[model samples]
Target: MRDLVRKYKDFLAVKGVTFDVPEGEIFGFLGPNGAGKSTTIQILATLLKPTEGTAVVNGFDIRNEPDKVRQSIGLVFQDPSLDERLTARENLYFHAMLYNVETTIMKKRMAEVLEMVELADRQKDQVKTFSGGMRRRLEIARGLVHYPKVLFLDEPTVGLDPQTRKRIWEYIHYLRDKEGLTIFLTTHYMDEAENCQRIAVIDHGEIVALDTPENLKSVIGGDVIKISTDNNEEVLPVIKNRLQVKAEKQGDYIAIQVEKGEIFIPRLAVELKGRINSMVIKKPSLDDVFLHLTGREIREEGVNAVDRMRVYSKRKH
Candidate 1:
């Protein structure tokens, strides 16, 4: 493993996780609520040291050389950390100052960043008045003020509409393509995870699977068999006890991974006696992989899935 992050759970905790991050590619970490996404990011970012296994960022051991590690990475937290009262330009300028960029260089970089995020016209507008998308973009601009080689983005497009989310994906590619920035991205959105060059599926503090999105979905072993049951939870165990492949309760429906979804659907219809409310069957998804790995839907309403798993080696938690 090139870079490793590890955790140990004792009487006080509920989970332990470990994983290796490959360099110079967009590595997407996927999991449900409380899947230790934050814990992993903290160790990799060198913000929280691990309990057991060590992490190396940019060839520097995090435990031995945290300062060097800190200098190599930039992090965009899930929450907006920008100063609400300050104008966007001012916020960025302050970050440039902290990085010790010369005054002329800071001005040039500030203008470039404001233009990059499409906020050149409103550079003087208070951050409090900017829209959610704009604030998110500005936060990203602030993180890049020092030109870090690796960017750790924790749900960068949280609470954004579809159009804005897609736009951020374009910016993510821009970092990889134009700037050659290595990215460690953790996202609950399946579409966002698919944009990565590779993905590592984490659940219960360990990687369940890792591969390219297309490859992972394609080789998931079976077509999906879906049955819209009255109570998805009640019937899942009954069906799972007899089925030879992976099965899960998805919302108001029961989904089975089998060789032929159509065939399984008919068999299920015969066995369940009553018709379902609705039924749909298709190939697996990263969402499906996440659910199957963690036993819960990725889009379950009203829960921050990422925060649930990230519960180790934390301070001020």
Candidate 2:
């Protein structure tokens, strides 16, 4: 996508965002709620049009050839889109028909996807009778019935248990490795974003940082030392002057990024002596990267009012 922008009346849900996903790679958009992840995905999937700029999906321009773009991609929305009254096989069959899959190959395709998601045995079960994990697996199977070049998974593992989420990721990796599918996913879960080959850290309708997980975490440089003291204001400057390193107050702690935290901790403990009330040391992680860039932790939150308005307007129109 090149300079893609989505405006909901006066509110810009998506700023002038730009990025690319390489073929067969698991590229992810990582951000908290209200950060425009869904709005961008909607634009890419042709469910919503951008206010400015455009994108090409599978070699077809989204603006000029929406039908072709739609044909070339599969989208599993953040919310459930499956028919609870229908059996799993029936849902996949409906999707196959909508994509105009050949009659001769439709059954074979449906069977293949069912097996891929390990839902072949339960294919005859009503979606409402299926567990949350099973329903999500069936949704993934339906998305793959047409075998599009790219798959967009919007919070594909949200609301599921840890074990179920792990299972879902297994199928995603299998699709990329065996089916050679390019996966574009949006997630707020830091651990989930780690599964991506590269991630775009978005905030407030803008891409704050984009890189591989390791690269993004490396921006924090080294181990993180979070020191909690009775008097942070008094200790922050002392640590900065004594260690000759930057120390910033994060929440109730003074956070310092340095190499060899294990080595530094001993010296720091000696330098501060009784001044330190508590201290914690750890390696850099995606959470740290987010905090470093955005000044806040990524937590579950409601969608932006503007994003909600955009969706409501789309439905009304």
- Evaluated with TM-score, which candidate comes out highest? 2
lDDT scores in order: 0.77, 0.89
Query: Ten residues in a row with the worst lDDT in model 2?
Result: 305-314
Candidate achieving the largest lDDT: 2
lDDT of 2: 0.89
lDDT tens digits, residue span 102-156, model 2: 9889988888999888889999888999988898888888888898999999999
lDDT of 1 at 211: 85
- Clash counts for all predictions: 7, 0
Query: Candidate 1's C-alpha lDDT?
Result: 0.77
Positional deviation of 109 in candidate 1, in angstroms?
1.9
* Cα misplacement distance, residue 310 of candidate 1 (Å): 12
* Model 2 residue 102 lDDT score: 98
Superposed Cα deviation of residue 34, candidate 1 (Å):
1.8
